[model samples]
Target: MPELPEVEAVCRKLRRDALGASIVQLRVERPSVTRPQDPAHLESETPGRRIESIERRGKNILIHLSAGHILHIHLRMTGNLYVIPDVRFRPSLARLWIELDGGRGLIFEDSRVLGKVHLHPAAHLARVLKDVGIEPLSSAFTLDNFTRAAKASSQPSKIFLMDQRRVAGLGNIYAAEALFRARVNPRQSARSISKPKLANLHTAIQDILHHAVSSADAAYAEPGHFAEGESFPCAVYDREGEPCTICGKPIRRIAQGGRSTYFCPRCQR
Candidate 1:
């Protein structure tokens, strides 16, 4: 799944290239994407509406439209969005395509078909995302706030971080990386962390996320070309059995909450 930084990269691309481009047409290549919800409402509400702006809320993209509607997109595992010249540019696994002005088209492709797209009234956008926790990149996510949130859970640190209702936009990749950076074990209970270590964890989380966004931008010529997972280098994520950057011990991958977590056993204690 695309985490915070990956989704931010997508949002930046959409805001730069697709904003102000009215949706000339809407095509749902996969009927399953429309779901039990009627596609007619999406077709009626999307077309002719200009994409005013794009914002990243947690791991989701909020497309603000001129028609007082917001197009919410959750690019779950193996899902990505692209802006290309032709609608038929890459027809392999496109789920939805937006025909925009200026002969450009935005395509949503998902190999697993787990991504979701919904049209919501702009006024109710808050309700749609009300359950999401505080944005980690925001100033509001101070050590005090993090401590308070952590007290509400006793799960492993990695699992606690991955909970969107506790701290928004964290996934296995970043959570593992953040725990490694903080020198904290992934299996440690959230409430068991000390104040000093909690402070370090908070700083590590922000630093890692910000560095990822910047590194992703520098690595790709176009924001639309950036992808998460292996595309971004990690300190200890998905490098199982490889030597840790800080310590010579082999990086290990363990299962936590049904997700893989990579960390250095020696360094991340």
Candidate 2:
């Protein structure tokens, strides 16, 4: 799944290429992408509406359009949006295509078909994303807020970080990396973590997310090129049995909430 940093990067790219362009056409090759809502409505309603701005909330991409409508996209896994010249469009691979006025196109492709698209009035956005929590990269994610949420949760530290209701946009990979950086064991109880370590965890989460976003932005070469997981640096995620970068101890992997978490047993206590 595309997390905060990846989604943010995609938003930036779209803002650069698609902002201010009016939608000339809405093509849904896979109507299942826009479920429950009639595809014909989007096909008709979206055209002629200019894209005002693009934003990212949690793992969703919001394309703010004229007439107060919003195009909400969730790239659950194996989904990517590509902005390319209309001449380069591939109908076979695109699940959805937004034809822009300037001979450009926005393509959403997902081989797994797990991604989703919804068209709704801007007023309904809150209901659409009511379950999402705070943006860790935003100013609202303060140390006090993080500490309060962490101290209140009895879940394990890794699970606490991964909870969308507490901190949005964190998944198994970033959660593991943040805990490893903070020297917090994945199995440690969130409520039992020391205050000082909680502070470390708070800073670590923001720092890692910020760095990941910047890294993704720099690595983004061109349109139609989505970032790969290996483009971002990882401290301990998926490095099980490998030597820890800092302490030279072999990293350990454990299953938490049915997801594998990697951490250095010696460095992260």
Q: Write the per-residue lDDT of candidate 1 for residues 1-269, one digit (tens) a residue.
A: 58888788777766767878888888877877767657777887798898888888899898899969998899988788768886657567889889898768888889899888888899998899999998999998999999999887899899999999989998888899889888999999999888888999999999999988776545443544545534567888879999999878999998888878899999977
Which portions of model 1 miss their true places by more than 4 Å? 223-231
Q: How high is the lDDT of residue 173 in model 1?
A: 86
TM of each candidate vs. truth: 0.94, 0.94
Most lDDT-accurate candidate: 2
* C-alpha RMSD of each candidate structure in angstroms: 1.7, 1.6
TM-score of 1: 0.94
Please give, for residues 122-221, the per-residue lDDT of candidate 2 as tens digits.
Answer: 9999998999888898999998899889889999999999999999999888999999888998899999989888899899999989888887776664
Error of 2 at 58 (Å): 1.4
